[model samples]
Target chain A: MKNLFLIGLCIATASASSMLAQDFSAGSTAKSWNLYPEKKAFFKAKVVDPLCTLTGSCPDNCSSGKRQLALLRLSDNVMVLPLKNSQAAFTGAANELQPFCGKDVEVDGLLIEDPELFARNLYQLQKIRIIGDTKWTKANRWTKDWRAANPDAKGKGAWFRRDPRVKAAIAKDGYTGLGLETDEAFIKEWFE
Target chain B: MFKTSILSCATAALAAFAGPLFASENGERITITGEAIDTWCYYSGVMGGPDAVVGAAHHTCALWCSAGGIPVGLLADDGTVYMVLKIEDDDHSNGGDTQMTIASHVITADGMLYKRDGINYLVVSKIIADLGITNLNHEDYGPVPSFAIPAPKP
Candidate 1:
């Protein structure tokens, strides 16, 4: 009887692990492969361009033109979804991570699971504090200056076209502008 | 009175489990009409803010984003955003970019709607593109490259 009880406990534990959202161990390239419970979770990582982070290629500063959100990448390279604030309703807090894009930051949020959301690493971002290291400060200043220069620019492509960094890329690399590789292409190459 | 209460409770439970595979609360299949917007931009309002026009004016940009693995959303006329999930296919023929080509174009989608944590999600079963709507100039960001697009068949 005791042995049967132990077996049952083991089975329960195994099932629980399957349901819990977990990181794809070190060196693994998977991003948010499953749903997470709606609870608090903390992570420290850099906010990278989702285009470059997920697909391994992009124009200078994510000029992909899609309204893609910034994604958080842990030190070990685990990707996390940074939630977005909506425009129609104009919530003051939606897409709060925009300013911190491409910078290292600490994030704590309720892990709300929604598979449809990119990265499947949904977090109801309770707090974000920038790391403010040398690398972060430089990138943060550039982003601020870029925004100041193009106050009316809203889309990635628009900003990309107007960006001096992107112009340098274009002058250096021509119309290809840092070469494009998208997530759809990655999935097709690997999974499909 | 006790018997009536038991019957009502039983019926409610039955309705929930016996409903269609992805039925909304009403146990009905729903069809929503709206502009297909990239989920990231709709929520973040990052590019052009939240009120940015998402139809033909932004079609190319939207397509580029949607094809890049960003989740596509159906921003309904009623101001509701339904995060769309593609029903998986074995051959992977109906990829995301195919859908984004119609970005910024108005279309009707038939699907089962689900509301979770105040967010709307739809398991889109069929998409009916309204080419007449696509042909019309709704708003403008700039010149949409004259890439030839075939109209949806009548």
Candidate 2:
């Protein structure tokens, strides 16, 4: 019974690890080739790109969101898997790599040498450890749970504090930049 | 039920993710005020930034390969591969030399700015091929010379 519980715990932990957004370890390389992990090597490199062309029908690609982005091939079968939590930054991702003429890079990933791509057009990735000295801490978000923390200053102070940029617009246009700070108005224009 | 402002919202977003490292410690938009011929650096040697960059289309989808290797079934031709780019207006400073948007892609290979639709959709995707922003001129983000170019179809 205890062993079963331990197995369950392990599966849950592994699932959570995949769910969590992690940065790759830096100043590392594919030092050795073992089909499995010997130990977690701290891995880090300036995040580059994958090896796929995105095709879409609309201006913003397909509205459907994806977790597994693309494949990256280094040598014949060398590749890496990089993932993101949100879909916003990828608009920049497409343009950053336009100049390489389809070749001119050295990728740093858990080097899986010559792994054949699967039917899903992906390599079967082996587990590798990533080392990140500076882990990104989650940013604070304003939420109902948050307002519960600070009720008093939630009214006028919160409104003004959020919109310091409003002062710039007001100065330029001779009118108050009101409604809300951030995308309160803009989101509606694009979305709602 | 809720109010969301795109400017202020994106402002916080810039501060949250893009802060302290990219523009300034404050995450403010830093327009370089000068040109560096910069675009986003695609780590992969092929297919430009679209295939390699995580989070461009879908953060997770772009990251699918971050764990390592999904075959991007792209075979290029023997032409100079070009990445899509957007231009920024010069009014902003301390700026990133990212790809200029079509509206702001004034300096073409022929040195003509694109102004169409009253809302410019003008930067050419294959500037290195089209405009010749090659390494001779590009100090920062130049074009790659050799690549996995496929044979042009007969």
Candidate 3:
């Protein structure tokens, strides 16, 4: 019975540690832009709507994900703006941090700072987990959210090409998007 | 005279490109004239080529993209792009009222420029002059993506 109790305690402790630990899968951008060796920051912060924090333009539930979100570091009360995520290309970290609005989370990311130039630093969030939660979540939700929002934009060579909005816009605005007159002139000069 | 202007522009471009090599720990203070652009579409090319994604043509789309949290970049006249960290008193890079108001407008900005990972990041302390949609590329490209301006409801 004593042996069984010890085994249970060990299992529980391991499970608890696993829950608290961070699992980070670095995105392509993070791997490329790790310029400052000493800038990687891990800390607890509350996810906030930067507009509200800076402008006092508080909205309900961070404007229901309409506005960009940020982290107000609990330790220093400084606002850290996570411009990019761990993703490839030029994706932003809005959707990834949106879910945790107003809640405290453990952020594992790079803090890009230039004290002489920028008074506020920028964050590239690689991974995050709720302060008391078990599993860490990678900051790569932009593409996933884009796909979910655009269901019929399928069979993509490039996502923009297959997008219905792009097709409609091109059809209405024409290739140059200048106006029908310019489009006609362009077509006449180039294609015809 | 034209040759001298071309040579001067080339020299400026070279200097901007080589900025990071000589950057101090305090960063370099410079004044740059550029269009405030939506960085995502400019780099992603989802809308169109770099040329097609600026000025009056891409103005509407730039506003939409900025509102959606894409960081705004200042595409300088010398063809250098600076990812704006903050502009004036606005804290957020994108989606700030200041950024939204200047979307696609060419303005002379005085700021401190920071270079990292071959990217130019600017924190604009003041905007000297707002040149209001000077590119006029829409006369050539329409709205690079066209869909930026929604069709009027039937």
Best by DockQ: 3
Q: Cα miss at A8, model 3 (Å)?
A: 60
DockQ for every prediction shown = 0.03, 0.02, 0.06
Q: 1 or 2, which is superior by lDDT?
A: 1
* DockQ of candidate 2 compared with the true complex: 0.02
lDDT at A9, model 3? 55
lDDT per residue for candidate 1 within B1-154, as digits (tens), equals 5565455545544443332222234323688887777555554333543454365434444554443334567777677776554422211111234454445556687876754323455656677655422422322332123221212244
What fraction of the real A-B contacts shows up in model 2?
0.00
> What is the TM-score of each predicted model, taking all chains together?
0.37, 0.19, 0.50
lDDT of 3 at A128: 89
On the 0 to 100 scale, the lDDT of residue A179 in model 3 is 48
Ten-residue stretch with the least lDDT total in model 1 chain A: A85-94
Better candidate by DockQ, 2 or 3: 3
List runs of model 2 lying over 4 Å from the truth: A28-96, A107-192, B1-154
- Candidate 1 lDDT over residue span A7-112, tens digit each: 4555555445434566423332222312233445556767665434333444454342222444445643544544432111212122355466677786654455
DockQ of 3: 0.06
DockQ of 1: 0.03
Top-lDDT candidate index? 3
What is the TM-score of candidate 2?
A: 0.19
lDDT of 3 by residue, A1-192 (tens): 654455455555544543332323233223335353215677788999755654455778877756567787775455666766777534577778988989999988766544322223566788888999978899987767767877987894644445564455446545444445755565455432
Lowest summed lDDT across 10 adjacent residues in model 3 chain B is found at: B16-25
Native contact recovery (fnat) for each candidate is 0.01, 0.00, 0.08
